[model samples]
Target chain A: AQTVTQSQPEMSVQEAETVTLSCTYDTSESNYYLFWYKQPPSRQMILVIRQEAYKQQNATENRFSVNFQKAAKSFSLKISDSQLGDTAMYFCAFSRYDNYGQNFVFGPGTRLSVLP
Target chain B: GAGVSQSPRYKVAKRGQDVALRCDPISGHVSLFWYQQALGQGPEFLTYFQNEAQLDKSGLPSDRFFAERPEGSVSTLKIQRTQQEDSAVYLCASSRTRNSNQPQHFGDGTRLSIL
Candidate 1:
């Protein structure tokens, strides 16, 4: 079984600042994927970024990026120049390569607040 | 049309009642997934469908929960004899392919409240 773990329950960052959320997972599969999803008060889950297990280079999308360390099974999300709109519940998810599609295993989330 | 959509943004049901939630996947999408999210918790996988075929349903917590995608585009999740524990947001997502690299597009979940 694959399990994702997000250590932070709550995080706060000032507007224009940067913050990082830590995530770790346990999986024996060599081929997998990692993702960071953000859910606002509207309860809509939004994809932030994703990383492929085989790719040594980390993934970056606009102001969001991931620090993926495959050996340690660590995937952390970094938000640069945070804005109020970035405030949301961030989830870390892992998925194994499968024929039917990937089965996502998500960690408990981290509530982020950006103070202006 | 551009993104995944879910019907009945909010649903309130009495215990033992049956409830059905609908999801419309993005046009041309081939994969659809259902997840359950309790308050303050992350979404948990419930089922997966590929082109009207239910490929995976191992994540369903109980036999009372069932999901189907008859035409490969629109999907429904049905819960029979719902319990208080079934009170959670039902989320639907879709992707262009079943590959792990494809990012999924999510819909604003249907919040199920069981009384």
Candidate 2:
């Protein structure tokens, strides 16, 4: 019943530049979690950053940070000083807890390329 | 490795053949999850396990798909009479517990190609 959307199919940024990937979701649950995952050619989905819906404060990890707008149902990732290694398929995911564990619902994904 | 481990990084099977993918979650992890990701698409939840109990399997695509975690650590996803549509990367993830805030650690995934 919950869905995540990544509007950008592909994006490119010059090295050392800044890039922001947009994401939005539809969910009635007021309490939930938003996440950004990066999947490289190696086939592993690595956690970039996560934001709790209850926390208005954005989440930051090194060069990766999230602009979480709960009311707007938008969660965006901003990568500063982008490097070549940042090139990957970035996915926006949603998860909310249940009696056992939460289920992860991921967006289509955005392919990012960092050029020199 | 400290992270989740999946076997046979790549698998090629003929149509209608049976294939089994393995996943080894992190030691002491209480929750494990399985997902299927098609080409150019995001991963979709297939099943979930809490320790040895399969609490949720609502995401499984069809009756041909089966998953089991007997010891609460190692798991296997078996597909019987596999079809072309079953060709996708099977991903496994684990977390410290069945908590909302716990981040899931993912394995590299097992890419299954149907020929």
Candidate 3:
């Protein structure tokens, strides 16, 4: 079974600053996918960023990026130029190559607060 | 729809009551997934459907939980004999394919409260 771990329970960053949320996972599979999801107060789970284990280059989406270290089983999400709207609960997820179904195991989550 | 849409944004049910949450996946999507999000916690996988075939349900908490996608487009997650612990936000997501690399688009979710 694959397990994702988000060590930080809560993180605070000043607006316009940068913050990184750490995540580690336990998975034996070498080919898999990792993702970071953001859940706002409205409870909408939004895709923040994603990284493919086979890809050596990190994934970047606007202000969000991920530092994916496949050997270390670590996929960390970095938010730059944070805004107040960036405050949300962030989750790290893992999914192996799925031939049957698509089910990803998620971490406990890390609550991020962007202060203005 | 442009994206996944779930009905009954908020549902309040008395203990032991049965509730059904609806989800409309994006058109032409090949996979649908249901997840439960407890307060202050990450969303947990409940079940998954590849088109009209339910390929995985190992994550369902109990037998009382059931889900179906009769037409392969809309899905319904039914929870019977709901308990207080069943109170959580039910999220529906869909993806173009069942591949692990495909991103899953999510709905806002239906908040289920068991009193």
Candidate 4:
């Protein structure tokens, strides 16, 4: 079984600043996928960024990026130039590559507040 | 719909009543998933379907829960004799294919409240 952990329960960042949310996972599989999802008050889970375990280079999507250290089993999300819209609950998820069902194990989540 | 669509964005039911939540996945999507999100908690997997076949349902908490995607496009999650513990947001997600690498698109969850 794979388990994802988000040590930070809540975080706050000033608008226009940068913030990093930490995440770690335990999985025996060598190939997998890591994802960060954001859920606002609307309760719509939106994909922020994703990283492939096989890729050495981190994944970047505009202001959202990830620091994926496969050996350490760590995948952290970084939000640069954060805005008020970035204030939401963030979750880290894990999925094995070969599993067609694509069952994702998710972390508890970190509530982020972007202060002006 | 351009993305996954869930019906009854908010549902309120009395205890012991049965409720059904609907989910319409993106056109041509081969995989659909249901998750339960309790207050202040991450979403937990409930079931999975590939086309119209239910591939996995180990995450369902109890026999009181049932899900079906008979036509493979629209899915429904039914809960019997709902209890206060059953109050939570039900999220539906779908992927273009069954491949694990593909990112799943989610719908605005249906919030169920048992009174």
Candidate 5:
């Protein structure tokens, strides 16, 4: 079974500052995918960034980037120049394809508040 | 639709009542998934579908939960004799392929309340 862990339960960052949310997972598979998703108060889950285990280059999307360390099973999300819109509950996710099918798992989530 | 769409946005049902939630995946998506999101928690996988075929349903907590995608586009999740424990936000997601690397597009979700 695969599981994702988000160590930080809640975090706050001042507007225009930077913040990083840590995530780690337990998985034996070498080839997998990791993702960070944002769920606003409206409860719509939006994809923030994603990294493929086979790719060493980190994934970056505008102000959002991920530091993916495959060997360490750690994938963290960094938000630069954070804006108030970044306030949301962030979740770390993992998925891998196997014989039966693809299995997806999510971490507990970290509530982030971007202060003005 | 431009994105995955789910309805009704909010559903409130008394205990023991049956409920059915609908999802309209992106037109060409080959895979669809259903998840249950509890308050202050991450979404938990409930079932998976590859087109019209249900490939995995191991995440369904009990027999009362059932999901189907008859046309490989619109999917429905039905809960029979719902209990208070089943109250949560039901989410639907779709992907371009069966590959796990593809990022899934999600719907806003239907908030299910079993009183």
Candidate 6:
């Protein structure tokens, strides 16, 4: 079975600053995908960013990026220029690649607060 | 629909009552997913559907839980004789395809409160 771990239960960052949320996973599959999802007060789960295990280059989506260390089994999300809107519950997820009906294993989550 | 849509954004049910939650995936989407999110916890997969065919249901915790996508567009999750432990947010998501590479689009979840 695969499991994702988010060590930080809560995090805070000042507006305009950068923050990094740590995530690690345990999976025996050589090929997989990592993802970060955000859930705001509205309770809508939104995809933040995703990284393919086979890609050596990290995935970047504007201010959001991921530092994927395949060997270390770590995939961290970096949010640059944090804003108040960025405050939300962030989750790390893992999925196996090349599988039909792939299910995701998610971490507990990290509540982020962006202070002005 | 422009995005995934879930009905009965909030549901309150007494213990032992039967409840049904509905989800309408985006048009042309081939994959649909259901997840349960407990308070302060991340969403956990409950089931997956590929165009009306339930391909995976290993995540369902008990036999009381049932889901169906009769026409491949709209899906429903039914919980019979619900228990307090079944109280949680039920989320529905959809993707263009069943491929793992595609990102899923989610709907505002239906919050189920079992009393």
Angstrom error of the Cα, residue B31, model 3: value is 0.2
Off by over 4 Å in 6: none
Per-residue CA lDDT of model 2 for A1-105, tens digit only, reads 899999999999999999999999999999899899999988899999999999989999999999999999999999999999999999999998564698799
Off by over 4 Å in 1: none
Look at candidate 4 and give me any clashing residue pairs.
none
Could you give candidate 5's per-residue lDDT for residues A1-116 as a string of tens digits?
89999999999999999999999999988888899999999888899998888899999999999998888899999999999999999999998854334757999999999999
> Residue B21 CA error for candidate 1 (Å)?
0.5
**Decoy 2 TM-score against native:** 0.98
Weakest ten-residue segment in model 2 chain B by summed lDDT = B95-104
Model 2 global lDDT (CA atoms, 0 to 1): 0.94
DockQ of each: 0.78, 0.78, 0.78, 0.83, 0.63, 0.83
Per-residue lDDT of model 4, residues B7-114, tens digit only: 999999999999999999999999999999999999999999999999999999999999999999999999999999999999999999999988989999999999
TM-score of chain A of each: 0.98, 0.97, 0.97, 0.98, 0.95, 0.98
| Candidate 1 residue-wise lDDT at A25 | 99
Lowest summed lDDT over 10 consecutive residues: which window, candidate 6 chain A? A96-105
Q: lDDT of all predictions, in order shown?
A: 0.94, 0.94, 0.92, 0.96, 0.93, 0.95
Error of 6 at B84 (Å): 0.6
- What are the chain B TM-scores of all models? 0.98, 0.98, 0.98, 0.99, 0.99, 0.99
Comparison by lDDT, 4 against 6, better one: 4
> Top model by lDDT, which number?
4
lDDT of 1 by residue, B1-115 (tens): 9889999999999999999999999999999999999999999999999889998899999999999998889999999999999999999999998776788899999999999
Given candidate 4, what's the lDDT at residue B73?
A: 94
- Candidate 3: residue pairs that collide: none
lDDT by residue (A1-116, candidate 1, tens digit) is: 88899999999999999999999999999998899999999888899999989999999999999999999999999999999999999999998876568868999999999999
* TM-score of every model versus the real structure: 0.98, 0.98, 0.97, 0.98, 0.97, 0.99
List the lowest-lDDT window of 10 residues for candidate 5 chain A: A95-104
Worst lDDT 10-window in candidate 1 chain A: A95-104
